[model samples]
Target: MPRNRATASPLFVPRKATRTQQRVARAEFAKARTKARAAQAPSRRREHEGADPELQPSYPASGRPGPASARGGRLRLPKHRMTTAVAGGAYPFLAEAGLGAEGIFIGRDLHAEGSFCYDPFALYNSGRIEGFTNPNAILCGVIGMGKSALAKSIATRAIAHGYKIYVPSDPKGEWTGLAEALGGQTIALGPGLPGKLNPLDAPGRPTGVSEEDWTNEVRKRRLLLLASLAATVLKRDLLPMEHTGLDVALDLVVADAEATETVPLLGDIAHVLGNPERLDAALGDQAGGLGRAADDLAHAFRRLVHGDLSGMFDAPSTVAFDPAAPMLSIDLSRLGSSGDDTALVLAMTCASAWMEAALADPAGGRRWVIYDEAWRIMRHVGLLERMQQQFKLSRGLGIANLVILHRLSDLLSAGDAGSRGRVLAEGLLADCSTRIIYRQEPDQVQVSMSLLGLTGVEAQAIGALTRGRGLWKVAGLSFIVQHLLHPREKPLYDTDFRMTA
Candidate 1:
């Protein structure tokens, strides 16, 4: 301590702060700060109250991660385990509640991994599904995707539920076996086939309709059938006078047949049309061009009478419709292959008219009108208009129509966009409350998505669906369903037997 430099003055040297002194100072500082905050609280509160919501600073609960973020960072949940029943309640998004147990058990729901069941009538009556307005359904898929099997299965199973099944036009004759197996009737018509169907045969009157009303309704139906036939044969729409000629001829034929106690025939109408004097005389003062206008109509009806389609639909029906039969399909496979669908179309028109007339009876009970291979008929506008009328009246007629198509785009083939045929096709689609989609071609996915309003996830799911698996959209809801076929049903529904053989 060599020269202990003059000892630093105690006054100039700083002394260490005492613990007691530090505590006292801190207490005073805290008191001053608390007082200042208390004075500012009222002003801050007023500012917040007066501020506009849009101008207020925001802290969203979810968004890009940042200091203001609701902490969307990597969230590590604790490894807490619970029973599935309990977990279902904790995490509702994982497991779903399914459609209840009612109606026919169709298949398995891929989402809930539970059994899937569907019955248009049941769904319609339950009022469970919102926006479900009708009992009609549309089944669309590429061939060999089990769409036909699904349809046949539905028809087979529905019979057990006390429902009737009607296949209006079976061009391929595939349903004949099922019809015969189920004790249903199958009428096969072709040249030299002896099976004849008079499209004009009147169905039994429904319970509530009066005799006069029923008679008028039959007349209207007959006129519509004739018009559709003539249009199909002539390859064009009938002119106004041609229509009047048909109208007059139908009245005359119906009157003579009713008087003679015999059913009307196509030949009778054609004969009445070929004679201009008869049509002209029938029109009275308006007969100036009725007979001439009917000349084309006479030739058109001639094709169904004395032409290549002779003896088919031109005479009295040989088979009476048995409505009580569990299933009824008109087997038209015997129709000659004339290198065109014309003969098939004409036959289908006649068969459909006959069956539809019987179905119009309100007391016919709940039934299914399945138009298998309906794509062929979609190309014809007259046929589409007729089918559209049936679609609109399905609910009131106490029936459901299951329109089977190879693909949704088949409807587009009916005509170009916005054509009359296209409008009718779209109308048919709109009338259906349920749409079942089997696996579609890659090109058809976008079309299906647009037509059915499918989401990105649904669109992806449908593209990968296996055979027998379909996406059933009931009302606005969706389900990935795998249609299960019973072992016994496999043989009956086996369309591959020809190849397997």
Candidate 2:
């Protein structure tokens, strides 16, 4: 074996082999370390900025760009080069940018409110708010602050922008004028009004009933609805027994099956609850004599609903709109004075008709209903929440509601403090996505600012707004525009013709 040693090859002879083995070992170690570091790190996409990765970097789908093939002569980016805004910054210069004129703008502006009458187009297009983001909006201001005027102006602009509108007529008069101006129809409804027209009831064959009957019916239904709401409120706040005066009145009306029975109910309440002292005590000093009035109202409703005049509670009469018209106005002044029961009836009728029309024309363009002085009748009816809920379900149907109130606390009338009335209002406001808050007292300003999540400067802005000025915000948009006054229309109101813009 010793003699054959030279013939046997050496165990390790090549220098190149040794170097290659060391290099392979080092590379394997480095690869293992890299994988371990990756596993230890958090499994989330790096977030250097607060941007939503899934949202398209443009307006609505209507504004989306066409595919490369459809671009014709334009040079296109490679398939892999179509990076999203999520990648960190703006798209490349060569990228197809979309800045279409399809969206509504919302942000801070410096225009005065009354100016809308003169330059409605500019005021509407000033980019103070983006309607597409939040279709809902709140118009909050104190009494005589011209909240109604501003609401009307904004609605007009919305109409110009191809939107439909629904407004709860305060006292039934507002709708008539606005409808005429906007080329819309005015339908009245309440206790007796039939919101629909019937070929069966046309003049001759119709049993000698006049149009007054239709008007009277609307009045009765409105009274009943208000009575029901007020009764519910009193039962919760003032009734001493489980069987309230309202309950007794209802029982009598239902049992008697006669309109005259309601008078006795009214007489009973007027005789007993009409004692000013007792009513004042029951409603608290702030409430005044609302209790007695409520009692009277309850009896009146029962009588109207069950009497020979029962046609007064036959539902609502609808005024159809002509989509081709420029405007239409519903005159509630003809119905009656503002605070009277007649006004209440007319307003409720208009609201009922508007709601019915909106629901029926679901495929119509965007429609909005603006309610000015909403607190007037809202206290006696549950229509606020009902309309709000309906509007929520009506998104696809192009229906929306705009409610203008002097204060946020007025929502308490819908229920109680323990109830979610305020919360519901807040949710409704938030859903609306647009807000126009004008100058208000410090207390109201603070409340508005808090709800909208504004800072000190923004809060002060709302409080400092003047008659034609307001703070406007459009949800999902970055800017908050300051709105200015719109131009005054020639003879905004006329007694002879009703609403003459």
Could you give the C-alpha RMSD of every candidate to the true structure, in order shown? 14.2, 20.1
Query: Tens digits of per-residue lDDT for model 2 on 1-501?
Result: 343222232332234446655555556656766787578445322332356756534433334333533544667687765343432134322221212234333222332211112122232346443454435566777765667666666666667777666654545355566666666766553344454321111111123445687435433443344343444333333343323444344333333434553222232333333343544554455533445444544444344344322333233333444544443333333333434453354345434544443344445555665666666545543455555555576555555667777765555455565564545555566676656676778877666666677767677777766664566554532122344333443234222343434
lDDT by candidate, in order shown: 0.85, 0.48
Going through the candidates in the order shown, the clash numbers are 0, 83
| lDDT at position 86, candidate 1 | 78
Residue 333, candidate 2: Cα error in Å is 4.3
* TM-scores, each model vs. reference: 0.81, 0.49
Instruction: Compare the candidates by lDDT and give the number of the best one.
Output: 1
Colliding pairs, model 1:
none
Write one digit per residue (lDDT tens) for candidate 1, span 1-501: 322211222122223546555555556656766788689768766766866888755532234334445464577688987774575466453343455788788888877688988788888888888899999999988889998889998999899998999998888899999989989989888899989899999999889899999999999999999999999888887888888888999999988998999988999999999998887787899645564788899899899999889999898899999878999998888887988788888888898899889898878889999999888888988878878889888888878899988889999998999989999999989999999998888889999999889888778877888999988888877788899999988998888988963
Error of 2 at 213 (Å): 33
Give me candidate 1's TM-score against the actual structure: 0.81
lDDT of 2: 0.48
Q: Could you tell me the TM-score of candidate 2?
A: 0.49
